[model samples]
Target: MVRKCSVAGCNNTAGLHSFPADLKIRRQWLHALGLEDREFPPRAGVCKLHFTRDCFSNAMQVEMGFSSQLMLKSDAVPYANVTPPARTPRPQRRPGASTSSACIQLPLSRDVSCQTDPLETHTVGTQLSLKTLLPHFRSEGVQANVSCKDFGVGMSNADPLGLSSTPVKRPRLDLDEQLEDDALEHSSLEEALKGQDSTHDPASLDSSLKSADSSTPTHNSKKYIVYESCIMELFNVCPVCTRACDVRTQRLGTFLSVKQWCPRCTFTRHWNSQPVIGSVPSGNLHLSAAVYLSGASFILIEKVFKAMKLQLFRYETFQRHARAFIEPAVIHHWKATQDVNLQSLSQEEKVIVGGDMRADSPAHSAKYGSYATMDLRTNTVVDIQLVQSNEVGGSCHMEKEGLKRSLALLESRGINLDCIVTDRHPQVQKFLRERNITHYYDVWHMAKGISKKLEAISKQKDCEKLKKWMKSIINHIYWTAASSTSEPERIAKWTTILNHVRDVHTHEDPLYPKCEHVIRKTTDKSKWLQADTLAFYKLEKLLTKKRTLKDVAKLSPHHQTSSLEAFRAVILRFAPKNVVFPFIGMLCRLYLAAMHYNENVDRPLAETEEGVPLFKISFPKSRKEECRVKPQKTQPTFGYVADTMDLIFEKVFVNPVPYTDALLAIPVPEDLSP
Candidate 1:
């Protein structure tokens, strides 16, 4: 029969056993400390009130080293004289039936109210004897802490109770299955919103999202050929040919949509891709464009393309279409605007033109070869020719042919002719002499030559004398005037050094006469004429940047080839890092990439993409300064055609003779002679 609980507001049944007064009060106290799960000995148990209140002191004593069996016989044992109740047999359930069961059972020694057992000390007899009332309270309040809907640990499907049905199964997948799944999901989304408003079309929205993604790479190739052709044919092309609204797939609000774009024009919002078959090219299959782009050596350029959500296609159909219709039209347009001026310019500019060749070092240095030219006066490169030079002489021939072509172009236009300068490269000099091109030795080159000689001298037995003699000669040449009026004094300075060295040591050469003449002469025509003292200072400045002589020598070639150095920096900033294929198209792309060097593309203020220029900024050095007498605008003075001509033009050595002009008729510095 049920008996009401003596505790206030606790009307639940007392069931078979009831705790007496003191034990009930002690049980209440232990329940507050959450140690109410323990039960007293059966013969010593109290009624329900005393069982819940006073049982904790006995449980605490057991926890404090009193054994349960000993506590059963101790003074804390209630109803020590009463006989223990006989235990009931546990019910058995079928295994399969248990699987479907939604039951949460806390251990007999666990508390229902306290979720956390900071000490795990909940006992059976302390709070209310669960063991004594097991038949009555077994299912009641047992699942109170757990929820029915919780998908507990390891479970893949939701459980009716707050526990796992079974260990969660990892979805087993094959490569094909994974791909198909992705494709199905993507296509399903595309199909769902297919007929929505054009403004909210799924494909159009998807394209816009892709454009947003593609803004980071140094270069982006959204529409290789077919798409561009379709755009031009379908929609009127931009006059500037900068911007086009080509929609690519992007998702917004769970719909695939398109975004119209123009690379030349700035737009505030994304346009929808017209899925009308022609928006993209017909018979053009989309392959992994991302894979092809990843193969590029220029990391930034690849990233830029990726950012634009563009893909490259090497399809035969696209290539044929580009060749048949697009290329011809583009070429025609380019020719028509070939003379258009794209750069700002000023009059009577002080331009310093420099050129250097970069060829793979013996096929052993493992380096790509190219020739580049820069205007030091403005720090802007005007030419970069990528011609292969390999172990096979074919590459060399190609390089020579390329150089010849460039020289011809430059000669066609009057550029870099006033006071050209270069290092003492025999091949370059040979090329220059044949063309009657007036040039000078870079002052830095001359100083380095002197410095190298001095360093060698310092290693000799007669080092001090030789070093002093070398210094005097360098100072005399460096400080000497270029005018013919100072020729006699220059000759006297030359003679003094030569005589001193001859008297102190003996050295012989068959070309002594030619050498002596070089020693005696003071001509601006010599390739090794000392330039401004400032040039020597710059060389020294560069030398001091390094620690050892080897480092100085190793880096010295780059110093001489400063044009190539500048070009390398610009290229690195924009080009791919790994470029294995030497295709002409890629070369053209490289040219475009170089053209975009240092240009800042326009971007919105809340820029989500990094490394994209919000607006274009021209190369700073493109323009010349205003002359003292005549004021002029700052920009490229010559139009694009003329600029191109200036870069490739070399009046010297358009045609080479075998014997006469190819010889070194030029003299060397006074110190090097004899």
Candidate 2:
């Protein structure tokens, strides 16, 4: 088999020869070739590159200088010039002989003696002068490996038998070792530099090299592990002051559930608390802002945070903790705002108050309903209450109990009401009467009631024109209320509709006897105002009802709950009906809506670049199948609800309450507790 050359980095193998049979000499030659601690295959040998011109015995070793085509002999050796260490064996003795009868071999004392008596003038080998011997050694071109650091003045001056000029012989490097180091040698003409004696064992050299090769991965593996993901030890030591422990804590850890502190400095920081790649998202406040405040779905939060490489608990955990943290705080803030709203209310003696209830679903089958009272003067939610069928002795309905509680909350807050406007729900009227609070019907509600009657009448063949006059009648009711202030003036203005519907805009009312708005000459008001007698009688029929007349008696255009309706719209966005929330969650969401509305209620919803008000066309949805679609322009406002929610989190959740609840029981969800 053609194995790679044992010499370091040398691949040539032609005419290879087994290295020194003595292991120590073999390692010395290997070290001289600069292949120290290199592992080679079994019985590996040197190529001819290490030998001089006269050392090889074959044409192949002489020509290609390698044993690439031939297997090396196991007993073959290099370095014919260097002699092995020589020692004579001990003479054998008979086992039975004691010292008295023992046979011992003895030799003449002069036979192997190197020492000659000082008085002797001649020696057996023939005494040679130093001058004669020194010339022979100098002409031999011998070299020895002598390093300068170990050289001393005695080495330069001292010579045995006065042979100071004699050349020293260096042990021959194996052909393999010389070629292995040949690349390191500058050129073929350059003599090899002598190397220090190698104490390394050829038998154990493989293990040491293997260990060195493996050490890199071992050290890197100690610092980090690669399983499903990388786990690096990080940030365990306190950066502020860890010098005393730095020797031991040279590498801080980066991983989950890690809270570290310096014993000496008391500096501390924390990592994941759940011992996983993902845990509570302690540092990302923006998640709360987007999820709870901005009404972003939790699934979206998960996708987004995961994309950003933010380690976070699952959305389910977020759902639990977020609701728990935000609900109570929102309620607390909602109550606090009541105080502020009431303080602002102190300036007015009698504030126009409008209370309305918005169900989670429509009125028939609502799981939850929130009733809120707003200050018409300030357009702020003063108080609100949420209810379910189970609450308040199982009323099995939303508006009655919810409105009662909302009113009771406002009353407890010492809010004074001038008049209340609401839909013509029988329960609401009864609630108002029981409390002896003044009640004015919502004009839109009354107008809706009149329009329902008009739809009934317009279906009759005699009252077909009532469909055209129907819009005029609705507009007339609001116009009359806005155009007149007191009961009699409102009465007189509303009565003018009988003549005005028959094309008599010139009326009997003192405050509004004639049309208050401009009358165009291109088209006569009389032409459009000339109401059919049948339509006139039809409108008059519905308009003359006692409830209808009573609503006009307390006409309050300013008391219309459009702002409350706007609040309801905002609440729908926050607590969307399709998404059922727990009782506390629903209430808190409502509170969040109320807080957002109150803060920016006065600001126009939209403005042009020139600061002029901009508006959107919105048509009212009505019960009439073929009603005129009169789209009205309404200004828009900036939604700062999410931004405000961020503030609430920073201020309120910064030091959160241990528990969050109001009248309802708020249970900690199982996921969050874990």
Candidate 3:
């Protein structure tokens, strides 16, 4: 039987609301219905027509067409006028006709009677009731909650719910098998609920149901290189009318759109492959940002896309994105990171940093020079300053200007420097002296300069014997710097090279009176540099050079700028010298490289499965054909790329005006061409 409004005048049954369980609310509802004098029947309800529009809690949603159901607010009472209809008497049951034995009563606020033949099972409303009853049945006894009596049949309690009391006779399965079955059932129920929930859109329900039926995992939201043919398959037939559709596809860089119209049923649909942020497609913006952050060349990536017949944005579009969003994010992130680093450094008594400048090209022809400073203790790039040749008056002076800018930045952050290590450039030395800053020469830089002179001398006729001692001389420079604690000790150890090459271990200097190595008789006399020979004379003069001695005395006893050199190599990946970039573009790329270096510089070396340290043999060009073993480090991660992407999408994309303003504030130099 259909439910009707409990109000006497109303016969309407749709959109009915059950009376609230609270006694006071129920009494008020009955009073409004003019039935307070009579006893209210259990499970009685009032049609929505009797309630005013203000009674609905979702009144706005209903009015805006977002919802079809009218939900009454709590404490709401029916006050709308009801017109009385002709009264009809209840139907009388025929004699000898018994109620259906399979009838089941539902546990609802309003009574809903269901009946069926005893031989046929009634499945309607069973699943919903079981969902509500399963927990109670599990906690208590299932037999006590559901039984033959609930099916309108009286039976003994021993055979409750008409289920067999004895356990199954089949052999028990393994624990894994039981768990697998339980997991499958749990997942099935979860999928069923996801599909059946009314709040979910039909498109989502369809996708969820399809996922439940498939064995493979979904990758709809992940990045993929999809083919045009594969995408066309989805639009071949209209989903609404199940007929042939005239589908049109449009492409804008990495963005794609599809429109389908069915000729038979006039069905139409439009879809885009990527979300749009303002006027730009999100995919296009992300691609441009990723390319810049990962130190990838856009031209190379575009070529790859072209070879694969894939769609991609133009270089101009990439530059536009960089200027508008990616560049500002880099500047913002770098400054924020630098501020934190500086604050941390400020707590220390004295910070020893290694500073260096890298030119975009060799010699005076270079257009740009970037100065990078690293905290020696942590081996992290703390700050980088980019200088254009034009700003510094000449390419030769860019390095000095870049270093000055970096020092100024560090000074502004209140970081106190105990000492700094750099190459012995005359301009740099003079500048540091004027400021009274304690400066030392990087051992590698001094050693490299000495090695070049020795290499050239060894190439001359009769000076070929010097080649045998070149490697030993370079190694001695590092040893002298590493072993000595003072200028006297460093000079004494360094001068020992001249005596040691002539098969002499005794030295005149009291700081290093004798060689530290064990005395041994030489089996191959040819290896030793004999006194008074041309090779020996050239080696002594070069080793005893006034400038060389001065640089050796100030060799950095602590950290060197090798890591800074490594950072310059990293910059090559971001801003290659072969490719020209605008001033801001070069600065942003330098920032990106610095971030990448700072994040991964201290990564641990890779290890084998047995916990043994791993190493790889490499033949470096500088080492000639000789192979050297180096530790194989763990894979470098691009976490900074993700951070940059987040910054762009969450902050920059939302309100780019502030970020653009910051980018615009940077002074970009005039183009060289015109």
Candidate 4:
């Protein structure tokens, strides 16, 4: 039978000499690679050598000299240069046996020359190597299988190649050799395991992992993270000082609570006892003078928070803590000015100062209101005090004391006064006269006096009309007094109205006994009179009769007590309505707000180059000099609030008095407790 050529496209029968008859495995490879024989033209069969060269060249070209197609073979063997048939055997020699054309037999070695030598004995210097054994075995006609196919049982009939040769049995192992082999194998296995552990160093590895775990946080660790906040780390250590001194204390802690104390320093400052003011603000706070100078009302405070975008805090808590922070600065600034005395000022310059007072409800210790004095020209508040008085005496006593205190402050500052103008309060009058200071009544206050009297004479509703009419008369009276041209005219007009009011009120069922008494006692001798001149009377009547002048004068400049009222407004602003901490915080806020106001006086105003309108203050040319002189006594120009503890404490004792029930009874709604 003819089998097709394994090469592609050839019809010639494949001969045993080229591909060999036992090529079942080779055929499978060819088929899988799509390399089976194809039809070649008639008489166009390729010889084995040419076919091999072409295949080698094609493989070389495909891979560009990557793997060589050159086959290797032993030089001494026939067909060594060609692919050998499977199951071929290689020749080998048997132990202690030799083969020859005559016979095969085992031969005794030369070392066993002695007849007593045992069969197992051999010379110690002699050993057989595998290479020597192969050559000797080949000479004995014994062959070894070289290819994997030699182990198969089937034999190929077409090719004289097969691996059915019987394998000789090796010698059986002895007991000692078997035991030694087991020991060597166990030792080798143990050494291998130990070597692996040495390379890895499990102990050091475990320690390294443990140390690494300790230094860093695990993914699930919990932290009390304060959002958008920064904290300044401060050391608690301080220099030793045995002597006690007042100081405000603050603590560095995980939470806002203050607990520990350092007894060594013995320094206690006002502690911020309030709760946390919410989260830390995200950005830096930069407040302007305008904001500082504004009233310290809760509204303004809230506005400041809004401007900064700080998270809002509880209103009460915010007020408490904010006041604590701001108050000290205020007191520091105010106290700094106390050393400057007004008396040292030139008389020609005159420290034209005004005094005023208002009540603070949250303050527990002071019954009388807080007092303030300002230099009218400078508009700066020079001094302030809290006066205490019994609810008893009257507003009159409070006024007297406040005036005295205001004058004392000027004297302490060494400022000298030339003249004073105020409402006609008896206490203010007495104080001014005693000091021999020239005094003029505040026209606005005088107008109020008239209105107050008329109001007493009418119903609560009719007081508005009475107030309007009285203001007109007060304005005309002042005009007559200021510009009458003659004392007789001023006196005639003043007395004529006084007599008319007295006569009209005497017969009627009166509402105001004091008003009736005041009218009946009218005289040219009083200071309310400009002069005893006749022309004053005619001018007063003519001016009073005119509707335009009356209207103008009625609303006239008499109400210009804006300076004193401004002082009250400032206190209200800095001291919120709901504060409950004995009103001490209020004082602090007040002081700070005032200082802020003064500092901002130099700010440029849009309307003018002269800068903002502020209370006038002048420092001496010798700016290097520190103010240390004692102040001189002076009279205050503004009328003080009447007959309260302010008079006794401020005027008589020159100290703050204990609070009375009357002052406490006055409702103050804005006090916030922290």
Candidate 5:
């Protein structure tokens, strides 16, 4: 007999007590009936159907040091009127009955289909309650005291159902015992299949299965490196001669290469690109590329190699690489400028040109002098000529024939220069004047020469006050040329400085007759400028000096070679006075520098919406009264080199061999040495 369920509509037996011991599984039964608490004194229980699947899972929940008591669900109808069957006691077994005793002590594992509570921690059996049989279960070495903590969480991996977590005591196996156990297992399986499978022998089948198991290996999932299968062979044909097939090779730096070759060739003419001992290129080892890329000084590169125990090439090799790679990169950029700046030649039928020359060193002795001619409208070098030794056969003139050569080259290119501005080099002035072309002395150069003279005068004890006006005098030379329209006006504005420095503000010319800048109305002692003083008389004599008058009379009204000076500085970086090279090598370096300088000569350093180039004010620290120096915008080198490298790799570089002058079609420079 069984007690009826406490659930309102359920008539099944109350197998489970609807345990709400920890309230994990009790919420559903409580919510279904609107109740606060439940008590089990009345044995108000319900069947397992009311519990969720989670409550019936194999994992058992046991609170430490506490028994799990259960009570009926509130929604369960009262079963107080029903009576459960009376509990029965088991009959005692006979003494010395080992088999029957063992049966009674063993733990039973049963599924939930038997209407038993699978959630119960105790094992179930037929004819007795597990709690009453606990003593007998312990006699068989079953772990009655062990709880969930004793079994540990990993118990489920070994036995998911956790029905047999106890460690049973057993005798250790000897060699004979091991053989007996294995024979017993095999015999039992053979006996069952003994009467079946009459066509096959078990012994032969067993041997075949053993062999298959031994041959097949299990695979595991993991990441690993896979080496290449084999080296590629040119094969069948010999490397020295296509007629022969057999050849011997040796390994070189992980790759295969020919050790010996036929007498016809000098070096090893045969090699395999593949490695005999396979490996991958793992890191950056391009020393030459890294040297230029990081902008590290060559000495520092050598030091780094020494520190890292890496092999550094000879110093000449680094220089050769510079000529090989960087020089061409710069030339490529220059040629691009030539194409894009073609509009520069469209400014006039014959554009105003400014010519200048740079020597290896400024002295009596020089190995080379490079003259560059620039079109005034476009601030870019039209062409350059390199003169070795003394220019123009060591002629008795302060001029470089390199200019004449460069100008001639430009004329052949259909570029006609209307007028040229340069310092009064005797031959340069004579050459232009003889051609009947207008020649204007570069105003800045004239001003520099005058300032040098003024600086010497300012150093005199009585003329120390003239130092303050040195900058003004230099400024006045530029101001006069910039302010005057005619050559006569240029002379008038320039000569006015003698009267102006003596406090004579008024002038003869209509354009700049009166001083434009505000005058100081102070009565300081140094401000007491008078024409009768020694400083004034000395400055007057220097201002009206023969060289000064000659330069000012032909002052360039609106042109100067200030841009060329900036380009020469770039050339100095590329060619560098401290380094020496062959004559052709020197010229190529100059071409590289010219291309780089011309590319961004007019680009605004930082611009506004109006697109005018910006100016920066700088005070010269060296010169107590230095002339104003104009600023050139910095050209960005980022990506410029990379683009040039692409041009070299794609268009210029044909092979691993060094570049040749014959390939580029460059003419050798003339030797002017006596």
Candidate 6:
């Protein structure tokens, strides 16, 4: 049956709103219609003509074509131009002739008022009884037959006072209750409909519907690797007719669409395995993002997919996605996070940071160099600058250029640097000196350099004894930097390593006159280098080299850049040197690596249920088969990936112009080829 407005004179059947179950709001609505004193039908509703436009929640959306329906606000009440219909006057009684036998008939369209006592007589026109009117009411689909004896009114079954002692049938007033039950039963269908828009394309509509489905409280969103055969089984049979269906399947990369039609019942359905954004499926975009963000090689992933006969998008498609959405998201999120970190550091009086440059390739053949500057206090990467080799004129000069850009950015952001620790790069030293910034050399970089030189000398025929003290010499470099507070003390302590390696343990310098270790007799007599021998002479010359000593004097007394080195290793995972990338692609990958590193830098060591720290044993190539025990860190979280995904789908995908503009503002260097 069609629904009409609850107001008595109005017969409009469109744009109606149901009566709210809330008694207070319902009373207000009834009062507005001048029916507050009567028992209105529960199924009655008010049309939109009786409500003002401001009462709708989506009035603007509907007007602007963004929405096709008008949704009323929860507290809305109809109050516009509503008037109650005038009641018809009752006919005069015939001088009260047998009034006790008279009966009243109420119209089905109007409210009916019933009395508590069934034996009471209601008079209208003639001397008509309720028993005579009951047959007509039953014929009109109104169940109102009642017997006075059934109500315990002391009436006899022998038709006393013309009343019968039969069962009563009351009118149903459960229309609103049944509607509520139906709404509850089909709530999921309502949710699905709410996500659809007639104005959107099928792909976007699918995306919206999928998003809505995943947002439901019962939905547990997870990704699974499904095979084609497994999916085909679901559409092989028709759900309506329980017969075979003509199923047509289409595959685009990781996206699948199935169309099924049943010949018997003419039932059909078109289903999409995953939502899409524009022509690109969400799975395809997400897969590209996951590989890039996690530093996994797409080619390797493609191989895995091929091995399993799984369809995947091409490399060009992945590149397209990266250039359009993934890269911009990475850049946007990194800059946002970096600003927060720098702002926090700017509040401090003195900020000490470690700076380092990592090349895309080893030696001078590198095409890209990324300089990462980290706040030593927190061990979090504060900034990253990617420099193309051609932009700096050559690969060798990219380090200085990257450093210049990073320091310039930090300075503009008001980061007051007390000092910076870095590898002993001559250009970096000169640049910092020119700027009057205090610069210290990382002890590890200096030790690694000295160890390489000593290792080379130990391989010589006459200087073979230097091999015995190589480890001790490297350890002394770290001890000297850690123990000494001044440059003179550091140099003094470092020179004593020469004496300690030989039979002598005393030094001529007053700052460090003797070895700190307890005096003990040597177990291996041939291990100690004798004074004036060729091996001792070579070792002494290398140790006291003028430049080496100069580097030693500036060894960092506090924080080191080992964390920065680890971040470079992370960069390898995202943008490896073996695979070439464009300027923006490389830069974005660097940002992704930095984000990953900063998020997990402070992860605590993994521990067992008994609170014992865990460790992993690895045989590094450099260790020559000797196993090194390293602390096992707790599993890292990919919250940044989730955040970036949200940014891409919710913000960037909605309006990509701004993110693309921000990306385009960066000065990309010309291609090196031409």
- The lDDT leader among the candidates is 6
Can you write out model 6's per-residue Cα lDDT over 1-674, one digit (the tens) per residue? 77798787789888788988888988888887788646587578888788765576544323322223466777888874753432334335445334442223232232111111232342211112334322222211112232221211112223322212332132111111211122332352222222222233332322342442135211114567777667667667644335676665555567665545444433344455665444445677778888887778899999998998877877877887788888888899998998899899889999999999988889888888888899999999998888888887899898899889888988898888999999999999999999999999998888888889999999999888888798889888999999999998988898887778777878889888877789999788898888879998888898898998899899999999988988888888888788988889888888888888888998999999999999999998766789999999999988898888877766676577889999999999888889
Per-prediction TM-score = 0.33, 0.52, 0.68, 0.35, 0.52, 0.68
Off-target runs (Cα >4 Å) in candidate 1 are 1-352, 360-368, 390-402, 413-416, 462-564, 572-581, 585-674
Q: What is the C-alpha RMSD of each candidate to the true structure, in Å?
A: 26.5, 28.0, 19.4, 36.6, 28.5, 20.7
Candidates' C-alpha lDDT: 0.34, 0.51, 0.69, 0.36, 0.51, 0.70
Model 1, position 14, has a per-residue lDDT of 31
Residue 148, candidate 4: C-alpha displacement in angstroms? 67
Between candidates 2 and 4, the one scoring higher on TM-score is 2
Model 5 sits at a Cα RMSD from the real structure of 28.5
Error of 6 at 618 (Å): 2.8
lDDT comparison, 1 vs 5, better candidate: 5
Find the number of clashing residue pairs for candidate 1.
102
Model 5 / residue 46 / CA error / Å: 69
Model 5 clash pairs are 6-76, 6-77, 7-76
**Using TM-score as the measure, what is the rank order of every candidate, best first?**
6, 3, 2, 5, 4, 1
lDDT score of residue 566 within candidate 3:
87
Instruction: Write candidate 3's Cα lDDT for 93-172 as tens digits.
Output: 34443333112223222111112111223221111222221122211111122222221111222322122444323211
lDDT of 6: 0.70
Clashes of each: 102, 22, 0, 69, 3, 0
Query: Where does candidate 3 have its weakest 10-residue lDDT segment?
Result: 171-180
lDDT of 5: 0.51
lDDT of 1 at 379: 47
